[model samples]
Target chain A: MDFLIFQIPILMVQASMDGILLGILFALIAYGMALQWGVMNIINIAQGELVILGGYIAYFMYMAGIHPAFGVIVSPIVMYFVGWGLYKTIIFRVVDRDLFISILATFGISILTQQLMNFVFGSDVVVAQSNFGTTMLFNSMVTLPNSKIFAAVVSVIFAMLLVLYMRRSKLGRAIRATAQNARAAKILGVDTESVYAATFGINAALCGVAGALIAITFTLHPYVGLPYTVRSFMIVIIAGLGNLPAVALSGMGLGVFEEFSDYILGTEFRIAAVFLLLVLILVYRRFKLARKREYLK
Target chain B: MDLFKKIFSIFAAISFFVSLALPAQAKVEGDTIILGAAVSLTGKYSTNGEHTQNGYNMAVQRINDMGGVTVGGKSYKFDIIYYDDESDSGRAAQLAERLIKQDGVQYMLGPYSSGLTKAMAPVTEENQIPMVEANGASRSLFTKGYKYLFAVLSAANQYLEVAIDLAVEKNGGNPVNIAMAFEQDAFSQDVRIGVVEAAERTGSTIIIDDKLPKELNDMAATLAKVKATKPDVLVVSGHSKGALTAIRQISEMKVDIPMLAMTHCDASKLAKQHGKNSEYALCAAQWHKTLSYSDSFFGDGQQFDKDFNDMFGYAPPYQAAESAAALLVYKAAFERANSFDKEKVRDALAQTDMQTFYGNIKFNDTGQNIAKPMVLFQVRCEGDVCANRVVAPTKWASHELVHPIPSWSTR
Candidate 1:
């Protein structure tokens, strides 16, 4: 109810721009979550930890005197193998089990990874200094950091590349086939096992990219990963599985909603607002599905 | 029957392990006096929690090495059993109960944050255990009539009001515009109260007062509002994360304000991390290395700083220093009481007034230290290296206060 956002009109433009750019990054992470959820049918509760692990890779690069921006390239490459190893070791066991089992297992992994990260990174809230400077728009009333612009651009490029690969690559077809029906794909001579592993790997790699971007754009800590996980989870729900364009749109929508809520409702309620929106979306979907069932009746 | 036996054996083993996992110690065993502590070893407050643990450990080691505390013709070494509170207030309260009821610990040490302290205070007070806490600076803690809870640091409200006074003094003693963002927590909210009081006294108009979330990182929206309505001074406090996030976003957005004041600059390592970008920021601290506070165990502030760095491989923040001072206060109380009795120790603590390497320890009836005034330090840079230089309380001013920090464009 703070009408300052309305009183000062340029703030709307600023909040919108900030939200969209921030949403693109969220979309990249959501795309990864959507992939694993659709392909392996296993919801990774450790998705945020993977993103944080990826960010630490870039932070280490920055610490080693290399530009953290290069981490977008390096982090995903490392994360792919980490994801593959994780699937082979832990995720595979929970893959065909109950959805609740996978959730609980990944939740355990999330806690373990957070502790391991705390031990490794010393529990400091850290950010990589990109020093790319700021980009002023609309007479500098709306200030945009160049690092954020770089992060948004990088996220878009990676998302596009991922889309193209999914459309064109052999593994991509196998993944889609497996995602459609694993038993059918296996019967049709597609190695659904390898497809599942690759899908998890690709999802982890996407999280890695998003992590590197976040390391530059926002602060990183061992415990901050859960919020990113929840945000991407909400975005995937809003967009649905395998819908790239919708994921992008919903990510931006969430980002804008968050920024506007931050400005109007104040910062303390920002996370609460996000959670409330998630609850609303869930209730709205439930009502819509219930209505459809009633119409069928 | 064999399968049933196997299941019974597994349960038996688990129960055995659970029984063994329960601590087997009293308040005093042989010549060692055990103190119970629940610190944040793994969560949001882990970094500061580590500092608190280290501070307690360092003091314990130094005191033991220096011939332990002599009480009633017997010398006793200090030992602490620590539980990880996980930075949750609910968990901290539970752990405090476990320490007192199950572990049989009669003496208590405070946790890292004020929220956790507030949570544990009731349990300690009910048990009549004297807890010397170095952190937990929320003003609300002092208002509560808890006889057992003792804080070695000043109340949270005193942390940043001096910065506001300094801003007005610099502004030709006229009431100035103030913008403040405080974390929604016990300590930071108390600091907000202090700033609000200062503003009210000076007839300053508050342009923006934002309450930051606990798990804060990004503050771009708040900065945007600050830019839209420029204020004379911006005050921020959230432990370490809030300080780090403010400097990062403020530098990124290049939001220009005449004066910027914050808390936890040292704890966050702002000067070392942000370098030139963090320059001219006024930070309120309980103690600085340049301070002249001295004692025999750690000598002076500079000596403590060096020894702490040598021991821990990083400069000790005020959190660690104050934590160490709490241990010193405990040792002094033990010596003065001249007995292992909890009542005598409690009375000794209540009647205590002493000096430590960190600061002068003199707790008023509210268990808040009133003797040591809070210090204000500015992050000053020479070349590319920046460090905190004491700038206020003219008695310890190592460097002059730089007013109206140069705008982002000039920098």
Candidate 2:
């Protein structure tokens, strides 16, 4: 009985470690989804496509004999310019439209981008191989992959920078103001249109970075983006819209919880655990908020 | 002048009537033989679909270059009419129907993934068109006993059994404990069942048999559970992504147990992806670059590798080898049938007992290739570079099998 009791913590620790690593990657991608959804309410289904585009760019760089780490750096800049161009032309016109129309437009854009990728890359699973070493802790019992650790560290640093920018910087404050009340921000002489475009550009650029990081840990294919888009949306909605920190926290928490469930219930039930977590979280939040409202009354 | 004008009008009216009736009266030409390909050229399974398409293209090119297929003492050039199913099963079935009925294509190939192939099977049976499947491996594809369909690759169970046999032998005379982590797809599930059944037959204990989601990225917790169970061997069954994720996590945890992997982990690319961490991982594959064969079909394996790399910019992965072998099988069937007729070609395929690139090719009554050889490879780290060298089934092994798995206590 004591041995079984001790095993539970060991399983939880394993689950949390898995969760934290996966969660950081999810948070990085989900940040982009949140930006697109919270600001324009566009629900860019192509958010995942941008990640795939970023991954392909990094993969090509690696194939060209560039180091994986250096390729990761170069991908975001190229993707940034691509995102900027996309915003200036295509996404700009759809900013003021109804949410559903914007979603449909982005959906079309996703299909177009996916097809274009298929034509060019031919749908092979390409990976960016890293030369990094692994670190073992707990007397060689718990091992951590260097690439995943690097990706997680980068995700945290980027998330922190984003939060700082949103809190301190003038452009960031203006973007926030616009998200909260666009007409009011416009009355204050803030160019909301430019803010919107910049937000989309920033959102896509983040997705590119996430894509680059993901390439280090996983294989890339043209249609791999759709699942990422679905997972990112789930993270954004579950974390609550427009709350970047909460999004990151929730992403990590979800990851850890998923790992725990996988440990306890087995990998067969891993996906089932995620859906169950989503339901539980939503129900708990609703109940707590309802109780709070009653107390306030 | 008026008489001439009247004659011209009458001639013009008659010519117009003839032109309209020509399309209705024109017979379908014997110069062309249509072969339909329904592959997922644009969706989730497009990676394999693209490779299959390349193989199909190469085969068609080679066949046409040899003066095409001879039917009834006359030559008919093969023309492939392909539709992109986008990896959707319903779309694959619809496209299969279109290829058979509208396009009038007799012989067909693929819908790539097993799910897509299963969806299109009813349509093929309804139309009675013979389909030479390039990449569907579900047991049901053969179990239904469809005479019109022929599988070129070995089933998932056969391949998994090869790995299990090798693992059991390598683990000395001890009754080994096994843990299985499989993707929730039909292919992986079949592999899982095969591993468990084989282990049971050998009196080995299966401590863990877990079914994971196809889209899962991390497997650390699952790896930890396997470790907790303390299984001597872990069997991972999934496609490339799931396999890579599981291997990475297992290696990261520094668990020093041998992993018997399915075909997804058989690629050299996985070794390249995980670098030194992939060391000691074992996987079963249909073809290895080191295998010795006759010079007639593949020349030398080394020369084949060089040529493939020169042509495709990268070395041919195992899937490419299988794809190449599949084409050879198709070519042999066509030549033996001595006709471009779909039913005749299928009959020739069903009766195939010939030598090809992968190995001696033979198909059973259910259309599954019975003579496909399975070879095992182990990932080894030498200094800085990691290599996947063939090390099992002693006859086909290019390297010696290393038993007991490298210990976590040592490195």
Candidate 3:
């Protein structure tokens, strides 16, 4: 009995730890998706591919004898230009179109990027070698890979900075105004097209940074990006669009929940748990909104 | 004038008939034999599939250059007709069916990963075409009593069993307080089950058995728990990503203990990824570049490795050997059968008692290899070169096996 009691907490600790570390990565990637969907109202299905592009950029940089830390530094800038170009040439024409068309266009972009990656990389698993395994934070037991911890910390810092910029900066304010009412922003002499392009660029850069961080822990193959895209979509939908903090929180929550499910039910059931949680959250939201409507009446 | 027109028309008709029959005769008369390959070339298992394809291609090239396979008083040249399944199992099944039915191929080589191989199994069985699996290790594949299927590589259970033996007996380490960290997949699950059963058999206690999610990126916390449990031995069953993550996390936590790994974790690439921190990591493999085999009609692995490196600009990975061995086994079976008939070839495969690049190979009634050699290797850094030294079978060990890993503080 004593042994059994001791084992339970050990298992819980394991589950929580796995969840927290993975949750940070999930939030970072999903937050970028939310930014594009909530502000631009464009469901960029190519967000995951942007992450893959970032991973390749870092991998190639590392191969060229650059330190992984410096590689992370340069990857976002490269991705920013890519995003900016994509918006100017492709996204601008489709911005005011029907939602389905936007989805289809971005989806096509995602497939094209995946195939392009395969053509270039030839589907071998690539990793960025670094001193990621050296840092042990919690008394030599709770280890944090330098790269993963760095990625999470950077992601959090970036998220906070973005929020502050949106609240305080003039350009940020203009972008928000454009998101809220593009016609009014245009009347106020704000260049809505430039704002949209810049915002899309920022979103793409964030995905690129996330990819660089993910390469530290995961294998970089062409197809691994698609599943992450699906998970990001799930996080954005469940947390509600534009709630960046909630997106981060729910992403962490989902990661923790998955870890726990992996411990208790088994790994095979983890996906099933994610789907079940999504259904329950949707049902609860519907019930709460129905009650609010009745109260107003 | 009517008789002259009739004669001209008949002559033209005869020429047309001969032209139509020429292509059929050309196809039948050629000394070329076609081997169909349904492998994942562009998706998740592409790495494994590509390595296997490279090995098979190299072997075929060498055989053809040496004047092809001599059988039934004639030499037959070979060509591989391959299609990429894109890592989709359904597509693999569909491709297998097409290769047999439409392409009219008598024999087939892998869809490398176990899931894809299992998906192709029924199709091959239904069509009664023999398929030599390259790198699939799932035990359930042969347990189904499918006669058409033949496995050249060691099964997952065999590899795990060897690892367990090394950990408990040879290393002189207590197997009590064992923990398993594995990827949640068919291949990893088999290894996990094997660990549990082996632990029970050896009177060892399992402190924790955890399945990390597929494509999991962060493993710091899991490593902490594993440290806390303070297991005598840690067993990791995963591919490249999971293996690297576990190794890096273990090193970060600085928990020094004997660790046993599946074949996926036992590669030079993982060592390169982890650098110097990969030392003392152990895994069971069907073939290692260092292991020796008696020279025979089939090629030697050491010579093959040298030739492969000279041709491909890098050392052939263990999967490459498995792939080449699979093809050699197919060639032997074809020669023994003395016919290209699919049923006759499968029968010959079932009764195979031969040697190949890896070592001596024979299959039992269940289509599983019997008496297959397995090597246990330890990662060691010599000067600037890092390589996995063969440390099992006692005869192959360059250095004595380090028993009961010293405490982290002492190290």
Best prediction by TM-score? 1
Q: What Cα-based lDDT does every candidate model obtain?
A: 0.91, 0.75, 0.76
Residue range A1-297, candidate 2, lDDT tens digits: 013215545555555666798899889889878976888778889989999898888778788888766655677777777777887888888888898888888899899898899888876566787756578666545667788888898888877888899889998999999999899999999999888887887887788788888777776878778878888888987988888788989899878777666666667776787888788878998999999999999
lDDT of 3 by residue, A22-84 (tens): 788878888888877776799898988999898888888888888766656788899989999
Q: Work out the TM-score per prediction.
A: 0.94, 0.86, 0.88
Model 2 chain B weakest 10-residue run by lDDT = B20-29
* lDDT of candidate 3 over B257-355, digit per residue (tens): 656454565542766766666767776777887666633433576788888998888788888888878777877787898987777888888889877
> Best DockQ goes to which candidate?
1
Cα RMSDs of all predictions? 3.3, 5.2, 5.0
Residue A48 lDDT in candidate 2: 90
lDDT of 1 by residue, B1-411 (tens): 999999999999998776556544447889999999999998878999999999999999999999999998899999999999999999999999989877878899999988899999999999888999988988888888889888999888999999999999999999999999998977889899999999999999998989988766778899999999999999999877788889988998999999999998988889988899999999999999899989999999899889999999988888899999998999999999998788899989988899888888888898888889999999999999999999998899999998898989899
Q: Model 2, stretches more than 4 Å misplaced?
A: A1-8, A57-61, A64-67, A70-76, A284-297, B1-33, B60-79, B266-268, B292-315, B318-345, B380-388, B408-411
- Model 2 lDDT tens row, B1-411: 999999999999998776665533212256766678888777766777766777666556656777766656777666678899988899999998777766666777776778988998888877777777767878888888788887777777776776677667767755688878788889888777678788878888877777778776566765776666677778887778776776666655666676546557654267777766677778777677788763354555665566667666666665666666665666677778987666777889888887655566788988888876677888888886988788876887777877767775666
Clashing pairs in 3: none
Question: Which candidate, 2 or 3, would have the higher lDDT against the true structure?
Answer: 3
Identify the CAPRI category of the predicted complex in candidate 3. acceptable
